[model samples]
Target: MDDYQRLVVAQFFESLPNLSPELCHQFVLRHIVPALLPKTTSKVDVQPSAFQGSMSYTAILHIHSTHGGHRIVVQFRTEKQDLSGVTEASCIHGSIVPLVTYQGMYEELFVYTSPFAEGTPYISVLTSSDDFELPLWKKMAIVMDLADLVTRGARANNVPPDTAIVELTTTLDKTQHAVNDYAFQNISVRTSISACVSYVLSQLHNIVTLPLTLTHQDLSPFNYLIDLSTGNVKAVLDWDGALYLPVGSNFHFLDSLFGFMTLKGWQDADDRHELEAAFYDRALDSLAAQGYKGITKEKLELQKAIGMLLYGVERLLKSKDEHSEHYLDGYLRGLSFMKEPISSSY
Candidate 1:
């Protein structure tokens, strides 16, 4: 491991005084190393990841075998937050494998029992994205390509009926409950807006029965690796959130919207609108090519608006701090669009 990586791991352990270093080392040797390496492997390097905002402890492992050397990222989650069910579902539903070989997406290498006897319960190893720098436009292209590939692949391959998709209705219902239960700082006005947004989304869900497809529910630009030099997408990361959803879910689009909004600040409305228009045009064309004929400009706008409102509500509900009112601004903006008739042409 590099000096920086060692320091990070040491700091992590230092923060947890009760945990023994020897036990942690043995845990890695016993469980992680074996699952990721060959018996003939002579050397291994483990380094703590520098990524932020993840709920799991992450590290990158370099393994050297007789054949060659390769790198893998390992993530460990607490028993209470164990992702075994999600991983198992991906495997059983045949979503993970095809994403790598058939769809040209990245591979989720392995999932194993965590070596930490307490607190942590499961560990997952996945292929690394190799960290290629990319510009905003390039990232947008990659997101569009991923959406197209997954939608087409789902239509071609008969995806099995999974409980995740079947439970989406229940999930939407819970989302409505979250909105109603949200203790807004301005409870009177915000609650009225929240209820209206929730009702609109529920109505859309009832009226539009779009064909389901494999969707990366969380499709932010950070979850992908793009080679800025060639404008090519090297890998699509983080399949833990992948599931079967409406073909034009717009999760990626919303991600791109909010991402650019943060980077450019909320004041640059023109550029944001331009990017949204371009993304929607490309998405509509791609879906049409895949024999999805029902999506008109009006329907596309409605879907995109609903996607924005849904994510905004989720953000507000998940926020634990007093900053929820700040998030409510986004929800209110989305609701305004839902109330008016949006232009079919961006």
Candidate 2:
């Protein structure tokens, strides 16, 4: 890259002074080019990346070497880096997770790179009808692939088993405590949402211990890059914050299979009952491998209902508004289907 181009990239981070000129220079030499990242780099170009991460400043590093040109996404973190999270996810779900090519601290900044994925983001398809044709079956296939990965990711870890004897009401009480902690104090809408919570709790009166596992909390459409031609996911991005949680918590992500949220409320897609049922069935089969005592499909669904209730209340806690409240009510009222009402990611 030319000096002027370097200056351009450097100047772009003026509002973020941590990207000092020296740090930018070494980033270009070490990460953008050199080593296995690409051999003997020659000409190059750098531009800001479109991947809008909440915790970092990101850019695209395009390099032309002896063999050919290559592209990598570089991120400078504003928070403590959990670089292993991306590597761990890649170890299991490499097909959908870009492997971290390199990671190091230039000065105090934590920077990492992964091969740039080539495809349309699932979010793009959701926004415009003409981005590409994504049929119902193809979307179903994507959901299955995601479900398989989550189950495998959980089992991949040697998590300590939940040795507590299976007492059903204990789990329900934990839900009640979470509600009292995270969902309480929002007096305006609590009453409106109370019936929904009570009904879910009642359904989950008898249950088994659900083993904890790592969950990709940000399973938004934008994080998934789709192969538009086949309607499959090519890469799952942004794993810096991935951590372990209850296995049933993943049910909240099922909303992405339907549609995304908008200001008018949720703009849902055509009903995919076939896909939805298949996903639940797949979950029951896969999670059963963990062999928690006294587990049953009914108990699993009960846990899902608990997950559904928590999903609503926790979200309500984060955003107390007429719009959020309106959708929270609709979703819990229909917890059997575990439908998502509001768009968490636009």
Candidate 3:
């Protein structure tokens, strides 16, 4: 490592007394910097990454090279077991290769040696998306186009592998376990929420029997890059949580829209509901064109509700770790959605 990088590592070690300085420095030189900029001899600046609130070991660096400069975000794990799953997910770029060819979406992947002290293996580096301000309509259009592409591409290209299904079921089981273990102040409320989730999962079994697709399980607004001038999505970020799961996993799109509308100061709940319904209608029509069947307004609503519950419970589980009140609020809001009855007709 260079003088600047060494100094940074020394500072980091000072703050993290449990970590070894020699090992951390070795990780920076051998794995982190090289992964940040491959095959470069140019002067690069390494700073703390702008991305925050992540559970893993993360570093966002601004790199200056001979050609130009760009930002690189990195996530690593200290333990071998914790590193394996993320490493495997990072390497699975092939699943979304077709979708990246479509307009309004982009994907790039970089794999390098693992930064861990032992059991070192390959890890991934991805291009961080740019932040651009755009009109609400324009942003929604970009998101809809991306959702369509991901859904259709999975349909036309390949069937979901057995391993993918196994992973999905495993995650669902974990969510169930988390729900059962939830430490709510009211035992009756917790029981009711757990029962609701169970009912939804039972209903979802039939839906899972249908074809599966590569889905951006986390589709928040912050995960996308948009060209403000044209309002087109230039890139999509954070594929580590992506999965080959059942289609209509675009609930994150709605979650993002809710947040966006709130941020934009939309006061009327009816207006937000209209926008969401319109987006769902457009999405359903697009998927239909690609030969996806069995989608109805009621089913779509149920899917979104189940998705919200899963997301909330997952966040609730994490709140125990991060002690964030925001996660607790999200979990309660998700439970409220779970209480709604899934009707057959809209």
Candidate 4:
């Protein structure tokens, strides 16, 4: 390993102090190897790139490990001499939270929590050298699976079409309010269109309240996956921030899916031709069939607003010690997006 690689490995291990060399080796073999390096009948082509950083670069290492059954990936990089050492030292002393903390028993949350203890196979980044803090891939898988389960369950319960529309609306409202409240309390950021937010909020609020369900608080492209083979969702990542809120909360996953599709530039005229209202209508009907009482768009949007604000506050408060303003911009952006028209789709 070069100086950079050595530093990267050292920092990873230092963060995850509980990680023995054996476990680290296993992780590399089991997870990293599979994604970056898939089965090749002939010679395999491998490209190496470094994770960008101001003072350090992280390189991917493909090494066959003896501890695990398969190959593994070891990401190695170096940091600024001054910052790297300080950063590693912090990990050595910091307390770590296992993914287990998110586990629980419930119809909605159960699908998510059960997987962890049940050997829900996943790849995790060995941060804090602890067996917690899941890697992106594993987290994504869990959320996607839970989303599917929720959809299926809704259908089984005889949910109605309006339920999904209501939930989606409600979620947007919650998110907007959360962002506004947090910004006013902790920062000076304000939205330009107050009426837009109100209009959207009102559209959703008129919808009736429904039973609570499981919703991933933070859903984005990085959080989900779609299996090409089965045309089914392979996984939904990032459950650390998962919560059991109103029915609208469930729509958070949809926004993530839409965002992913949109970002990939998949929303072309041709793609739209393949997609019809039926695609969404059927899914929404399924949720209603599953017995979901639709939440008004207003309620869901408010909840989403609140959720965003809480998350923003969390980032600011946590980083206050370091005087980091990293998430402030994001907080403001999230609020701005919330105060928009409700007729806008996810």
- Tens digit of per-residue lDDT, candidate 3, span 1-346: 3454456455544545665434433455566666545787766544433332233233444556676766544444332222332333434433322121111101121222322111100011112222223345754666565655445544542534454445556766777687677666545545555665555555554454444555666666545555545545555554545665556555544444433222322222224454566667776776677687667655555555556557666665666543322433333343324436644323
- What are the runs in model 4 whose C-alpha is more than 4 Å off? 1-11, 14-189, 192-208, 218-225, 236-242, 260-283, 292-346
Question: What are the clashing pairs of model 3?
Answer: 49-60
How accurate locally, in lDDT, is each candidate? 0.47, 0.61, 0.47, 0.37
Worst 10 residues of 3 by lDDT: 117-126
Candidate 2's C-alpha lDDT? 0.61
Tens digits of per-residue lDDT, candidate 1, 1-346, equal: 4464456556655545655335443455666676545463478766555552233345555667777866555554322322443453345344322222111111221222222111110011111222222345654565455545445533432433354334554656676676677666656536555554455444463325555566655555555444545434454444555656566564434433333233222222334455556656776677677677656554555445455556756666677444545444443453334446543332
Task: Tell me the spans in candidate 3 whose CA falls farther than 4 Å from its real position.
Answer: 1-15, 18-41, 56-135, 156-181, 186-195, 198-206, 228-231, 250-253, 260-270, 318-346
lDDT of 2 by residue, 1-346 (tens): 3454455445556667656545665676665566544545367766666544445556778777788878877777655656577878888776578876547666566777778888766766666665333677778778876666666655432433343322334655665565555544335345545444454445543443455566676676778877767777788887766776556665656666755455665545556456667777777677766564344555555555566566665676677665666555544433453344322211
The root-mean-square deviation over C-alpha atoms between each candidate and the true structure, in angstroms, is 8.8, 6.9, 9.9, 14.5
Q: Write the per-residue lDDT of candidate 4 for residues 1-346, one digit (tens) a residue.
A: 3465456545555654564335533544454446445773223222222222222222233333354323211322222122232233223212111121121222111211111111211221222224333334433444444444434422122345378556656655665565555434324333522444455445443433444444455554433334432334444433443433544444433332221222222221222212322233444555566665453334444544444444544555555522223333333233334435445433
Pick out the ten consecutive residues of candidate 1 with the lowest summed lDDT.
116-125
At residue 278, candidate 3 shows an lDDT of 65
lDDT value, residue 242 of candidate 2? 76
